[model samples]
Target: MATSGGVDVGAAVIDCGSFLIRGGLAGEDSPRALVPSAIGTRSGKNDVLGHSLWGLPELVDQVVDVYDPMAGLQAIPKWDVMKKVVDHVLSKHLMVSSKETPLILVEPSYMWGVNGRAAAAELVFEGMGLKSFFIARGPVMAAFSAGRSTSLVVDVGHQGAFATAVFEGYALEKSKQTSVLGGRALSDYTYQVANEKAGQNGIRARYELPSMSGATTEKESKAEGSNGVVDSTAAVSKDTAGSEEKEKPKDGSQDVEMEVKEEAVPAAPPGEVSKVKPTTVEAPPPAPGAVVPKEGVAKTFSLDSKKAFYRMQIVHDLKQSALSIREIIETPDPEANGGGPAQTATAAAVVAGSKVKREPRPTVYTLPDGTELDMGQEICERIPESLFDPRLLSDSKIPGIESARSLHRLAYEAASACDIDVRRELFGGLVLSGGCSLFPGVAERFQREVAAITPQMFKLRMVSPSLRQDRASAPWVGGSILGSLGTFQQMWMSKQEYDEHGAMGINRKCP
Candidate 1:
């Protein structure tokens, strides 16, 4: 997604999850192009309510050399944390940017309240003394990134993953878009496993802190266990005052205390009973299974220990189910058993239009609390015959698959309407742009199964964007590039035009 001018276009895109806010300036094609879309900040300043106290702040050593600070951000009230992230990017990027430009802010569809995302984008730019334009439709931006005449764009983010079809440069309004329980769900899952591992080791319960590191950072540190010295750059956390938490060795053995903590795990008062109950809630207890690599002890993330982190591995693979569930539950049909989901053209619309999805069936994972984390059929997958056309989920009784199929049915039907068009002309390339595209077999699955659920009239060929790394940003970057066209003004409504015509009128003006 290249821009038109001799004048460089500078913009920052932010993903504000409940736990973390990721801000990244558009970068050139490179290995780690998007840089994990994360930011890190101190305990008090990063959060407004100080909820961050629930989680440990990045260690001083972690901060000074942290390539991307947000990676350490714990799962907290994401919008607030995200705002801080936006402010951080504004300040940090502004120091090096030209204020003479408009900073385009691409936001998630569910940002703040209704219409709040656009306003937030406006405010972010205005506060920075830069004119602002909002790119709220992530799927549309991704479609723009596709730059093809016709294609499908699937965007999987940390918090959500969705799919959209683009035809003639615009998203297909009626296409089925899915919102799978995303990275946050994965974090929650990992948190559970870490806790379970801890409890299994007889470490009594305490509050668990939200934790994750973009593999870019944590993976390197995990690998460096081969080195003689502990990577001093790893983030540090403080345990409760009483517990004398020992270092977890890589070989699953406790050889010695290689690292030192300033604060000892405090012990309870003499004969005082511990309030931290082993049985409390379905969620995992903090640090339950977390292997705190002692500063000096060599370490490796154990395979058994790594299952908690399954969310990241499957983010790209199983996210369609999540989105499908969000779509169905959000459908407008009053008779649906559940409370209706958010109402938008996206009605699970990842791209141009919207979709209908049943409430996701709970994905049941054995949680520490003698309970199972119910992620639903939408979230859990077991080598389905067709990832696109899942039989178990499509039960007419179960709203999750029923409704998801409903969305696909609608999109496929519409696609059938365009049967006369050649797929070679329609989807010259299948563009897979999203965090989930990072998953293995996504392309194969789509080609094999997506058509099964659709009408048989059309032949499908798959195409995807070349830039797979910073996929979350690919669509926005692509749209930004197209928007650079001199003729684009013909389709754009001026602020004055929008003001003159009310919302209805503005809708008429939209490109």
Candidate 2:
């Protein structure tokens, strides 16, 4: 059992999917913990938890075997699954904290107003032990490691990218901040373009990246590399391969470029795939079932590279425009009305030299060692060139960091209230957190832009969190420091006090 005066400790940070819980027995001991957000259960064994195998002779051992009770929350919150998780964790750690030890847990800011959290927290405390404390808001915790006083925090994870700007350690109101800025925007942006490119021709393929999956284990591409993004759409069958090759004019001919619409290109048809070579063969967006080589053919009509180039141009516009909009929104002023031609042109820029005049693009997301994401940044870029918003690929980009764009522009209302100037000797250090700052080039790129935008007299630098550490940990970092002090009666209230004065009292103590 954990005691305040003893070294025993139980601490956890819970995100949407997983809980990273760390525990130690004494002041000298280190925390041993893991956060597995998923609950996998065998089908048909049972649909619920605590369903009672109490008297069944055949179920005696089965009761002991059940792992996660809150397994299926697709239909319900499955608070029971959470209970089973704690039990399973304690069993592994050999701790007697479930009924005697105290716990300090963390969660997201959005959970504050929900009634479910109150009940959930109660049940967890009741099941484990009444001596517990809660500290929700992990992005704030991760930012703590940055050792900064004020900064933007971007927490990009599996389910989505979330961003938060904290000033003087206070979590600002959503009304005071703009929403629709983060990773889901990136994923959605990437998905629409990928979908259009793959659907171009008649080849239907699966995407490699799982929907709502791969936040932690995926490869390090500030965005997409083999580990970052996969084209499951290319999960081609043996028959599918035979068709792609058969469709390619059987003769090995580089002279014949078979052009198709942005919608006609199949997803990575596995034949000789050179790095996405630019081709102008546009064949009137091939008829349904009309087999066409995604790249070139041996015999027949020369494809229109203009259309392909047109697609690439579209991608350029989307990336640049989206980038501009995010910058404006990130630094918005109360009197600001909207955007202008330069902002509009950012999305409209296209690559030159091709038969089709289109916007240019940056090299796509790269692997850790810096390999081009070979996925489809180019192809994806192409689709956005021509499509307007409301068209799916129609990159309106206003609410999109989620959108794409460039750093070029000349505009300002009242400069952002939060843009605190920093002298290198004092506050040049910017602390980053939130869910959106997770994009690859954000920090480095933002630094370059900020320097360009600011008066040259002030030098600036931006930093990202240590990889794999949660942004939410920033607050926990501060909490960890707070946790390791004299037995201060001021910071935490006793559970016994809660028994007398209740939940409201608990908030008052910490609030």
lDDT on C-alpha atoms for all candidate structures:
0.35, 0.33
Residue 105 accuracy (lDDT) in model 1: 47
lDDT of 2 by residue, 1-511 (tens): 3433344454432233322333323222223333332222212233111111111111111222223211111112345556554554443332444556544444443324344445455555554565655544444444445765454544432222334455555444341222232322333354344334343341121111233123222211221223322121222223543453322211000111111111233222111121332111111122222223322121111232222212322232233323221112123222221221111111212111113333433435332122333334444443322111223334534233344222111101111334434223111444444323323334433443434444433333444454423332344454454355465224554567657766555455443
Task: Report the lDDT tens digits of candidate 1 across residue range 307-326.
Answer: 22222222212222222222
Which ranges in model 1 have alpha carbons more than 4 Å from their true place? 1-27, 30-82, 93-99, 107-114, 179-429, 470-472, 483-511
For model 2 the local lDDT of residue 52 reads 13
True-vs-predicted CA distance for residue 500, candidate 2, Å:
2.2
